[model samples]
Target chain A: MMTTETVNVQDEKKSAFLGSISSAFQGAETYATLRKSAWDTLSKFAIPGTKTEAWKYTRVGKVINHSWMKSHGNSQINLPEIAIGGLRYVFVDGLFRADLSDELTYPGLNIRRTGENAENNLLGTLSNHQGDWFEALNAAFFNDGLVIEVDKNAQIDRPVHLVFFTSEENTASFSRNVLSLQESSSLHVFTHYIGSEHSTFSSVVTEAFVGKNAALKIDKIQEGNETAFHHVDWTKQDRDSRFDITTVTLKSSWVRNDLNIRVAGENCHSSLTGAYLPSGKEHVDNHTMVDHMVPNCESDEKYKGIVRENATAVFNGKVFVRPDAQKTNAFQQNANIVLDDTATMFSKPELEIYADDVKCSHGSTTGQFDEEAVFYLRARGIGEVMARKLLVEAFLADVITTLSDERLQTYCTEKIQQLMHS
Target chain B: MLHIKDLHANIDGTEILKGLSLDIKPGEIHAIMGPNGSGKSTLASVLAGNEDYEITGGSVTFGDKDLLDLSTEDRAREGLFLAFQYPVEIPGVSNINFLRTAVNEIRQYKGEEPMSAGDFLKLVKERSALVELDGKLANRSVNEGFSGGEKKRNEVFQMAMLEPKLAILDETDSGLDIDALKIVAQGVNAMRSPERSFVVITHYQRLLDYIVPDFVHVLYKGKIVKSGSKELALELEARGYDWIKEEVSA
Candidate 1:
């Protein structure tokens, strides 16, 4: 713990720095009190230190103390183009680029930019980003992201993609997004976070409200540069809804994602999965919390991590079944493979239940590759490299193949192989 | 041609083969019959270059290469195949794919281009038919859920696919039924040629009944105790290995 004098100095420096660049950053100041309340939350609970229980395996002080938190002004060039055929909305450095985005015209869907419309009809939700200290910081400083509304009983035929690309190494960018699906609506979403060779800091916060009998499938891919740092997302669910969420992280020198999902309604089904591959001095940590507050809802989670060289990967999955959430079928599994002797992996799969009739189980395993399987493949004339690749893919098939989309599945598989071999 | 001169091997510091010698010609099929603890399987493993067995004082010559210096896979590429007593089961690897990879790798080692997919598929169909293997079984993981007889039949199917010059069968009839034994023997007999030789290692004379060998050798305690014509197998079957043990001791 730091002394009182040092704490005050750090706070003074942080606010002074944030205040100096406040004039250059602007999105929509539609909710004055909401932004003030968000700032208050961050002040009450500052960035955590290493002594904090939740920050035991990670340290964020170095990131918070850096000068990259300063704002940038219209630092724009023609960003790298992508040929993927989807309705994409592009953002560079937390600023929307209309030249790079697609035209938003579809039935039962409503899109509005934070810069185009302050508060953007998502006023109340925007004011309530107090999940954690980092989220509060995101709420206080976030300038632009997206706000999408799906009408009741609407069914989206095509996936909507959101690309967040960054190309700065000495500044920070924060994007806050809001999504709502009324009764019986369904949609699929793809979110990509890409960075140039060196990006200093980045943060993303998403708040969702899923109505009764609604369905939402979200596939998130984080393929930033080795110098890129930081990510955070939060979501909430309503009654009788279905949520299928998948997250894949390939690169990033230091990244921490905080996902808190609350299923407030009965009979809801939620499945959360993630695959994180890191190598060569990278550090990626995922802290997920799924709260089941009502009865008869089920949730399943499986996370796989592969790390080599001196990299470290951490997975902490916490599932909580409330007192009245009976007959809940919740299963959680976390498996990891540390290839090189210098790599490290930390896996903690937790389950807390108060209902006696509920069924909940969690299993965690971390080990090296099975040598017998390798020898068997080699004996069949496959070389060592190709043999190991086949074995690794087979090991991760159960999780990565869960993606129902064929193109996306192949993309993820190739990306994983490239990173692992690199 | 294959020759073993004063072969000696050890497993975990325990000597299993002591001064064993044999000569195999290119056109002859020989049956090696032995009892338990007679170094039968050890010879098969050492010939296949299993790392568990150390060659202490031995020299094995196959064709133009010193067999001891070659790797297990290199030996396979050089037209040497071993039908293991217990074929290893590998999950998540297709049986047909494994065979094709083995065949192509062997061809590549011999400086030949890979076979086309269509031709390879045709070959698989023909080879699979030799043992009456189900078409769907080729798509399944290698020997994962196979019955004991099916596993033995798969070994013969693989042998037909690879078409090796020297095939070593180690205890191929341990637990097979009469029908499976006939099928396995038929597959091997169909592939027999003047240029390809076979060393069939078995503990019973029943397998040799279907595919008679040119000669029969009784392996007792680490050496070949007797060598005679195919009629020797029926004599050893009528009397048991104990009679051969007594004869060798005398």
Candidate 2:
């Protein structure tokens, strides 16, 4: 039998970690409840892995086994550019920087720092083992997170950007955030993961709750240092609502983005798109799960990758339609262009449906540029290098067009161009 | 002028062109008529410096340089062009961009500066008009989603843009309708000049009617078995390739 002392050691360590996260909060009652619940859950479970079906390809064992991961331990981080134009919220080493935060409080918008309650009915009751260790660790140790509530009938035209900045050398950080939108509300929220050149692990788990008849547009852009190991898990959603999520991952030594979305209410629409350009020995993995649990839902997903040099890319997309989810329409396509023979890509588009009436399709392809096309271009007088570059640009241009923000689209296009030449 | 002496070539260890020889003056138009497997297309591909065909024995002289020694793109820059039987479709690259890169590459090979965007666009408009290609298609991806006839016409458009000294039409009329054949041939005819030459490879005598050749040669078993005036194409059209096979084997 395992002694209580053995379990208490683990619980004590978890509480110590939770203590660091609690320093960010102000209120007392909510902080005490969240700290107790986080400690209790951390005592019960360890990190999950391949035995967990949803995390089959995205391994979190290496992430959890690294004992260096802590709560960033009172270290001061001088944050970089957090705001682009309109809004900016900076987090230093996973701790929200209040001085750097802007207070443009407006109607129908409520922003507060809230702690997770020990006995919240839906948020903390169940363990999300669905095979992500980082997500489990985040749920177990997340003491404080942002709570965003968009009131009913509110339409926010300006984009809300969530900037997550962490720069710690040889130290690991774990952070969590949650956003909730009420009925008939609409807004665009952007999340950016920026870090410095450090041997660090930044595990972030975000949950978004979209009420019935709401609309939300989410863009998650990751620009971490090449030496950082970043794993981000997003539990985003649409419920009788419209939700769009786009991620652009440009730099990282090893990065895994796990995105899970559900059309929990009827007549919902969701679009998920991502573009990743990985170079050198870097590895970028994007795993997506879009569940159409209700009827009359539509989802479209397109992910493109440009892998050069010795970079490796993995894309696994799954769409599930429950038995009651009839008339579900889902389309998914993943295309990768590998420039060098040494570069590698593994892509799988999976469909699991129990509904009889649905239109579901998935396709995946990985190959080099067409040789005949190269010869055709060369024969017309184009040099070998210029021809290859043009073909790659043309391949990735469509995905860039999916960015609704004009400025983001232009920036990503220029980055892609520079990446191809690099 | 282009010259070929004792040219012998093989693909996949099987000889396709056996000791064939031909010569073309700068202002002449020549046609080589043969059945499906008589190596008519192989000769054009070889002259354009396609690497798949092995030259067992051959000497091709284009102006003052040896043709076979250069790469495919190098031969292209040397003013040799082959209008493919099936033009390759390059997705994503616009036709204008493709042509501009090709034109600039050739210019660079000649020790000239790159053409400006304005000058290149002007050249594209003028040349596209020669083939009646839509300006919209020129702005779209190269040959992607184009019809069979449109692809062949685009080949002629490229040939006109390059203004090569020697243009080899390798079965350019194979899959074209009469209207498309005439349009492509008209584009070729417009590019003809006293300082340029042509080699038209075809199976039917119909394309010969539009671009009449100064000399006609019958190729059989990889060699030119007979050479004559334009009337020989008419004679072969009347009597089939069976006689040429018999004459060559005999």
The TM-score leader among the candidates is 1
Worst 10 residues of 2 chain A by lDDT: A1-10
Could you give candidate 1's per-residue lDDT for residues A1-422 as a string of tens digits? 12112233447656754564354454546557667777665556545655555566777754665666444546565554443466789887777878878876678888887545556555436333553566666677778788888999999887878888877666677787778899999988888888777646777878777888999888887887844545655566788899988888878888787776888898998998888888988888988888988889999998988888999888999999999999898989998888999999988877888888899999999998866556555544555676677767766766777664767778888877887787
Q: For residues A49-105, what per-residue lDDT tens digits would candidate 2 score against the true structure?
A: 454454555555444433454444455666554344646676666667767767737
B1-250 per-residue lDDT for model 2 (tens digits):
8989999998999999999999999989999998888889899878876778899997999999898888888889999898988888876678887788788889989999999888888988988898889999999888889999999899999999899999999889988889888899989999999999999999999999999999999988788889999999999999998988888778
Candidate 2 segments whose C-alpha is farther than 4 A from its true place:
A1-46, A58-62, A65-86, A97-131, A142-155, A182-185, A211-214, A225-240, A277-279, A306-310, A338-344, A420-422, B111-116
TM-score for chain A as predicted in candidate 2: 0.83
Q: What's the distance in Å from true for residue B24, model 1?
A: 3.6
DockQ of each: 0.37, 0.58
Docking class of 2: medium
Per-residue CA lDDT of model 1 for B1-250, tens digit only, reads 8999999999999999998899999978999987888999999889877788899997999999999998777878888888878887876668877777788888898999999999999999999899888889888777889999998988888889888889999888889999999999999998999999999999899999887899899888888888999999999888888888888778
RMSD of 1: 4.1
Clashes of each: 0, 3
